[model samples]
Target: MAPTSETLTAERILEATEEVLRRHGPAKATVVDVARALGVSHGSVYRHFRTKAALREAVTKRWLDRTSEALSGIVAEDRDPEGRLRDWLRTLFEAKRRKAGDDPELFATYTVLTDENGTAVGEHLADLTAQLTRIVRAGAEAGSFETTDPEATARAVFHATGRFHDPCHAREWERPGVEEEFTAVVDLLVRGLRGR
Candidate 1:
């Protein structure tokens, strides 16, 4: 049976594109392959995403958003900002590590896609830093953190913890004592942020 428009949404196309990329890698994957995976025409996939780059970008955004979505709740919770910040960082690290370890092929595909789709990656970084800024701002308001510029502070913290969450450093994630080093870094960051 032909898939109706409702069934052939952009989301479905992106999902199929992801599978195609996972199997064939970015260099070999094509819109037609994504369409073939969905049993649809290439035109059908193009209707949802104007170009292959667009579809790839959308899939990359979706993959990055998974980590952001996982950490979003910690920002919304009414707990101490310090605790929320710690939870958010740990959750993000775990999410990235899981993606890299559990589905390395797809994760590697996304790493390439993310490099190609700089705009999507930028937006994702902005969203993450925004979340961090909120947590920092809350901590400041509660007299637990000292930062005149939460946005800058958040960005600093994000960069400082990059090795723990960045895909480029994924290979080191499983090294012995990596988790201990991660805890040490987080503790130092939190300590530096603490209000006098």
Candidate 2:
């Protein structure tokens, strides 16, 4: 049971759900499990999430938001757009690697949660791509980049760098010399975006 002092808000529920998901994994984690972890009834959880799928989707979005929120700070930095772009991408790679390495169980659980919650995943991607677009557009405005289509260019850069950040490519992130490969890819991407 949660301490009585701690209210069972949506945030608390999401937090407990994440722990539950981590403990039992996506295949077996349930609302009852989350409620049990909270020392509340399943009915209380439903009052906040409405449905079992709703709870899962909310938890998945919360998980993805950790990365998105971190990247958004880089996007908001008032630095050379090219440098900001590089830092942004590197930060993304580091964040993904940390998630996979620091908590292998939770990371594996999120892989399944993400698959089951496409809308959450889609929104996360859109948020990420939008952040990238802001950086690309800023570069174009400063004449640091040549592309007129910042949105398209952002999309390309994102897809091109997917191996660094995509969970599906998690296996490749720790390969020997993968950091060199990531640097090479980033260099090529930055060079491609720069003016002649």
Candidate 3:
């Protein structure tokens, strides 16, 4: 328990909210629970977040931002664009797999939250596709890819690899030969992009 004298911050409230959500899930979690976890009043929590909906939405955005931040590093790396694309896809797949396998309860909680907060989910998808667009544009600019529209190519790439990153397909990620299947698909996409 945190000391009552500790100043309540949005980050602290968010961290507590995540733990509360992880323990109780989105349907059952409450702002009061988060406040209790943080040793603060629910009013203090509300001071940072205007309402329960706002708190949940902010937490969902925070969760999604973590993946975007992770992938942004790969997008910014100065390396062979093709290799960067491959690594980027692999990193995404691995990140999803870890989230599903490592903390399935939290993952399930988030799935529900994502459904409730469609705007946040949509924004997250757009951000991810934007990162992919940068990578594809770099590849095309470097003459490693043949694409008239990098944004379209990025969308295609993202959709093509959805099986690996989409939460709906999480169960299959642990299936036998999933990595081989992912590699084959990535190879085929890379080959297609290379104008082979």
Best by TM-score: 1
User: How does each model score on lDDT?
Assistant: 0.92, 0.93, 0.93
Instruction: Tell me which of candidates 1 and 3 scores higher on lDDT.
Output: 3
- TM-score of candidate 1 versus the correct structure, residues matched by position: 0.97
**Candidate 3: which stretches are off by over 4 Å?**
1-6
lDDT of 1 by residue, 1-196 (tens): 5547668988888788888998999999999999999987899888989998888888899988988898898999998999999999999999999999999888888888888999999999999999999999999999999999999999999999999998999999989999999999999999999955
Model 1: lowest-lDDT 10 consecutive positions: 1-10
Query: Model 1, residue 146: what's the lDDT?
Result: 97
Question: How many Å off is the CA of 18 in candidate 2?
Answer: 0.8
For model 2, state the Cα shift of residue 16 in Å: 0.8
Listed in order, each prediction's TM-score against the native is 0.97, 0.96, 0.96
- RMSD per candidate (Å) reads 1.1, 1.8, 1.7
Q: In candidate 1, which residue ranges exceed 4 Å CA deviation?
A: 1-3
Tell me the tens digit of each residue's lDDT in model 2 across 66-177. Answer: 9999999999999999999999999999999999999999999999989989999999999999999999999999999989899999999999999999999999988999
Q: In candidate 3, list every pair of residues with a backbone clash.
A: none
